[model samples]
Target: MWRGLRVALVRERFTVDGVAALIGSAARAALDRGETTPARRAVRAAGAAGALVRLFLLGDVLPRDEVAAALDPVDVDEAVTAGLLDVDETGVRAALDLRPHADAGLPDAPPWWVLSDLEVAPGGRTADREHVLGTGAASLSLARATVRRPVDTLLDVGTGCGVQVLHASGHARDLTATDVSTRALQIARVTFALSGLEVECLAGPWLEPVAGRRFDQIVSNPPFVPGPPHVEHVYRDAGLGGDGASALLVGRLPAHLTEGGVAQLLASWLITSDDWTGRPRAWLGEAAEAAAPGGLDAWVVQRDVADPALHVGTWLRDAGVDPASPEGTALSERWLDWLAEAGVHAIGFGFVTLRRTAPDVAGTVVCEDLRQSHDDPLGPEIEAWLDRTAWLAARSDEALLDERLLVPDTVALERGLVSTDEGWSPVAATLVRLDGPQWRHDVDELGVALLGGCRGHLPLRDLLDLLALAHGRDADELARTAVPVVRDLVRHGMLTAVA
Candidate 1:
């Protein structure tokens, strides 16, 4: 048993070329047979390829039980010493590292640690300190969540590990990736090459490579940590304080985006007491000045909030810095000092999606900060919310009554059905949660309903009067409660005002 386990480990490390070829061939064949569609094929290939790559690095540590209980103490020791197995005894794992194509100003020679067979380290003792290629959950989140759209070109600013480039390859016919670190571009190239995708990886600051190029889609996961700056990592720092880097990057988008183009990004922002809205809005002003006067739709969704210390600590850990270590402690001190110096106390993290289009085109800019379950994003709920809003925003009380619709017996605020931002146009309905669904309100059942009753003939005001009479509520009170709800529904597309 020990001999067989040792053999398996050797095959995983790719140290034994014959075993590696066999593992690679089997995994590839399995993936090919499993894939039925392009999406499935991509998923299968990525998973199978990653597994095969891991086997080469982490083979020696495979549990003895899984391999007929053959692992010996010496085999485990040798594997650990060789840097192919992790320190943890039970859960052996491999780091997924990648880089883009060459000519991105990265070093021509690969890392000595990388084994020749799969061109990656075989459990080499390498610390992921550098802001190199992406191999994190957030990076994958951005990659997978991105939906393909019609676009002439795409830009990935601050492209690390070129994960964005890898995902963007399928969507954008032409792709350009930029990073301040030439080393990052180098890594991005390696990743892209291994994955069999081509992208123009540039070694430069954000938007520098394509100073005048216009793209239909632009996506970035910029260095969004807010802090003071001295020495900076090209992938992270913008020589600014809390969310300063994000501002700096966002402030540069309008001129770079083509007409009717959209830019989606995840970033962090400092929440100020004065007005949370003004800070991010300032980016739009800067963008407008850089390009032609056009329609701009900005949607900023704040997903999470954290205090300065928590924020700093989270980022420090993310960069693989050990706070317990002397160097890590010093780095942490510097980060805290930077935040203090920046006049920032708390930070908000979330997404910002912007669309640049023609003026006079029906477009909108929405900023919302809401509590949501991150683990379960209700895509269907959001879709339903949108559908209800569309129906509401398009019709008037009279029209709604004419349709002779039955009001739902009850409505609950299941999650989100309202616009949190001010200055939105109004719709003429109320949002109520129902049994496993959301629906409109019954006009007759509602006492002093904000919207008119569905009497099948009466205009909105008369229906309100009828409701008012039934409920013994005054006109002023009823109007105050109902008009805004109606307006909100209209604005939100929950109810429609007749054209």
Candidate 2:
């Protein structure tokens, strides 16, 4: 049935690009924003594809004959029996939210369809306990942030509807998806079957299903919501109090990863004080001690932070509860009170990337806030980060200085200019990266001169000696001071060692 449905979808050109062509970009954008009226209007005259669009994407009731025509090879009776559609005297409607998805980050990757339970409209009733989620912002963010190099095997923990598996298929050789909810696993099966991809599905919580087994890469957008120790929705709440789900994965996932394996996860942590990294840092430290002698290299990037009230309200709305309603007010009060008692002033949402290192090597843990807008895919940057950090870890100051270095074109030196009586003068200089994290570093005259001399032509030691001579400073002292500064630049990709 799934094969037949796949064929029919292909025959009808029910794909991401195909749908966009049928409906204008404006309608597509509106659909992404959760408004389907524009799409319904645009596809009103569209033909068989239009019928499918209306029935499936827009959640509209279409004439039975029209839906049948749209899904030609697969009979309407078969579709209904397969639980893909519902038929009644009024018309036929989609039983599931099946929509075309193409990884915009991977342009050459093939398009696929995702199958999951329908989304609840704003102010609609709350979702069921086991509701399977479709492609959402969290999943898309993890997809863009994942390091997508070719790997022997990949595992997606909490594989809700298998959207991440679809994104991983292009690079990973073997795929496995695990979910605690059997209903989600079932829906993920349908999603994979319809896309003509094979993935092993296991039902378990966190890393239990994959215990004692390791993979090259592991990715998850788990149920990381922080609240009371109760499960309201299996798709969001983990039934563990106060961001325990995120900590659980961070602690245990390293052991389930192969040597040099990488795990990318979307997680949320509680912020009790000004030290936002405190919780995550402790989690990584504990995980490192438990994993192996080599430990784990971790990078936690906090993308957003929300106060307790706003966080509670946001999640309440997500659960289809109106904050203005009496029920919403009661729930919000209880949740906020719980947070206050627990000393959770805010909630931090971010990406956690961990790499299992060799037993002989020490691991690096970096925690920082990066709330800036990133328009491009972060996979390359993340991969480069791991590589750069590894390179820095393997070298000493003397070894690093002996090597020549060059700055990539992506690194630009921006000068802050102020209008003076004579002319515009440079007051401050900052090094800005045009790509990946867009890190900016303030520099002084010596820092600027040092970087200027790094042209991949001479060793850094020689360049530092020249700078010291020009500035009338001791070469040994300058080198000692410059090593750490150069290491920071290299760690952030502003400076590259010439090879």
Measured by TM-score, the strongest candidate is 2
Full-model lDDT for every candidate: 0.55, 0.90
User: Which residues of candidate 1, in runs, are more than 4 Å off?
Assistant: 1-130, 144-147, 376-499
Query: What is candidate 2's lDDT per residue for 1-499, written digit by digit as tens?
Result: 8888899889888999999999999999999898999999998788899998988888888888898788888899999998888888898988788999998767887669999988883348655889888998889889989998999999999999999999999999999999999999999999999887989999998888988899999999999999988898998899999999999999888888888999999999999988999999989977797569666889999999999999999888888889989999999888998899999989999999999999977898999889998877777889999999999888988899899999889999999899999999999999999988999999999999999989999999999999999989999999999998898899899999888
Model 1 C-alpha lDDT per residue in residues 103-222, reported as the tens digit of each score? 111233221111111222333312433445344556655554454554669998878777666556655788888888776676566555545566888877778788878888888887
- Please give the distance, in angstroms, between residue 71's alpha carbon in candidate 1 and its true position after superposition: 24
How many clashing residue pairs are found in candidate 2?
0
- Model 1 score (lDDT): 0.55
What's the lDDT for residue 488 in model 2? 85
Candidate 2: global Cα-lDDT?
0.90
Error of 1 at 191 (Å): 2.6
Q: Which window of 10 residues has the lowest lDDT sum in candidate 2?
A: 118-127
